[model samples]
Target: MHIRQSIIDTSSLEGQRISQLRAAVEKRERGTILASKYHTAPLKIAKAFPMGDALGVIVMDVSPGLLSGDRYELQWKIGHEAHLFLTNQSFTKVHPAPDSMGGSAIRQSFELGRNAIVESMPQPVMLYRDAVLESETVVRLEAGAVWMGAEVLCPGRTLRGERFAYRSYKNRLNVYDGEELIYAQRQVIVPEQQLLSAPGCLAELTHTGVFYAFSDRIKACHAECVRSTLEAIPNRSGHPIQWGVSLTYKHGLAVMAAGTAAWLIQEALAAVWRMLREEMLGLSPISF
Candidate 1:
């Protein structure tokens, strides 16, 4: 496994803290194993456990949370015929970023070899008042590879009566098959600058979630199945939940949802994840 050098220029960071993790997995006769791993301060992998034929990894953050001028970079490579399920240990808490610093950022890149599979389902992000965060994820897949990922965003520390108090939140995701870009999405949320409750926006929702599945094996029937699965989820009367599923440009599907609570969005995404696993990998539901 070849790990790429960091693209961040420390000299330009002006003493800002940088944390990084690089890991690769490969399929062996016994099963998939962690082929190589490296990490810096504040970032660690708890352990790798077996989940049927797949390997499960949980990333940990030792610091309280992200602070101003903090940057995190993660790279993951899965070899051919390997399956990896990735998750984080806790919510990504982004503390208030000073006006001068602007915000913290996280960058993640995943490379999948032929017939490789990766499922990344991290916890929701909690942005405190005046918090700003910029997140980017890039996925590169070879032929016969499949990738699935999910993310949920919280308005703030709702229990503390905070809602949409963050300075800014931006996320960009790109998926590529070999060298061809297949799907891309950019989401930017500036609560102070935009009317989030307006129609076509969040509209009375406090939390939002997104899920994506990409593979050459995906078909129209899978999209319909996702829609049906989402519709079957029961929603409470007063806590309104809205969601939609759509097929991507090619070889993928995307699901988006908004709700009053983070659990509402998380449960919905989990259901979709389970359904997709069954449909694509013929695997039974495995609880986390």
Candidate 2:
């Protein structure tokens, strides 16, 4: 795969840094390949490696982290029967945003052709004191398409005693099958405005993780399997971790976990991912 450089005309928006990445993957007789890719500064794909039958691509950022007024736009197009696993290099560090600009924003969209599959698993996000972030993701899946995504959120620099020091964090996700909207979720966390340690809120948990699997192949049996697997998972870290699994209204399942450590949440989500990959794709556990 060749990385194409594109120039963005940022003459209008008052010197705010805007980065963009557009990529497409297709399936051929050999295997899934990166058909085309274009990226601007602060976002690039060095190469696409093979992960068994699927293609793995890691999104890289040249900048230290997201600063005030920074915007990232990512779009992915997956051809029929293609499988792509997308991840990032490291944690998404969000620095404090100016009160005027509000916060940094991330906009991502995915278009999956028939029988296509995409797994988007990025690393955890770290919010600094007074940091603000707003993220939105939209996915459009055609017949027989499958989309899996997971996210881990960290309050702040916990070791620096900056937990819950951020100003606000907001995220919205929408998934559509053809013209029908199947899933919609909006989450907002304002540490300074709300009582995050309350019973109804995050309480004692400092980190949160969410995993979502959506496909037309999802069935009642799959939901049961996920539930049983989650129940059977042991807490070897001795950390208080809480999790739950739920089936969507149709053709989907969600796993949510909250814990004191990021690794605890990651381990729980990895277990669910392995189970789903075996039951749905008939594939072995992913190596990375």
Candidate 3:
């Protein structure tokens, strides 16, 4: 049996940021807040709130988690000058359905307003054997807005000899400003069919992750500054990670693709985020 649910909420304040939440359960839609749920919603586990942020929580034990032919979507919109951070208390593990005669799929999307900021980083995603997962995140930002995000993935678990264990996992992210595409990335992984074990692929690396920051208001030498920071660090091969920092019209973007253990990626992201917060944006660190 397949099950799903959907939840949506919208909030606006005269001087505060607008809040919106959308979640699904049992393949149905329910009007629920990020902290509350209706019938069939995922079980609420632990939620945390830090200073200068909006929402933080974890919903787990999702009934029927995700089965073949299942689809899930979540969307949020932040008003001007508002800030929000969302995180999953734990890593999301994808397991093969009992009767997975076919394959499973998932999709996630986000939209933001001008001058709005969001930071969402949890643990890495684990893909089990014979599972197929497809996730897409789309962000629409206004001119002069900012966005920072990170993602981690394991090709199954190396300790378990689960090499290329999954059928496939593809994730795509796109950022736009008023129909103008600013940044776009597409990643597709197939253990059984791809060059995951090749020197260029995961290159015998167990886990990999990427972190990026994009902002148009950054200074003229913003891209160069970011590149210098990456050059200062090292990569999985004892060299600097494959770093790419560039400047576009009204925007500066930096992407780091590192081959290392999951924990290392997390710590590196924390450091990079801190540097950007203090030096680039002059904003205090807002933990989720």
Highest TM-score against the true fold, candidate: 1
Taken over the whole model, the C-alpha lDDT of each candidate is: 0.90, 0.86, 0.58
Give me the overall lDDT of model 1: 0.90
Give the runs in model 3 whose Cα sits over 4 Å from its true position.
1-40, 43-50, 53-65, 97-102, 231-252, 286-288
Clashing pairs in model 1, backbone N/Cα/C closer than 3 A? none
Ordered from best to worst lDDT, the candidate numbers read 1, 2, 3
lDDT (10s digit) by residue, model 3, range 25-120: 111122112432332234343453443343444545354444555554455555555555656656667777454344554445555556766666
lDDT of 2 by residue, 60-138 (tens): 9889899988989888989999999999999999999878875888888888899999988888999999999988888
Candidate 2 backbone clash number:
0
Ten-residue region with minimum lDDT total, candidate 3: 1-10
Q: With candidate 3 superimposed using the best TM-score fit, by how many Å does residue 29's alpha carbon deviate from the native?
A: 32
Better of 1 and 2 by TM-score: 1
Q: Where does the lowest 10-residue lDDT sum fall in candidate 2?
A: 1-10
Q: What is the Cα-based TM-score of model 2?
A: 0.93
Question: Candidate 2 regions off by >4 Å?
Answer: 1-15
lDDT of 3 at 258: 58
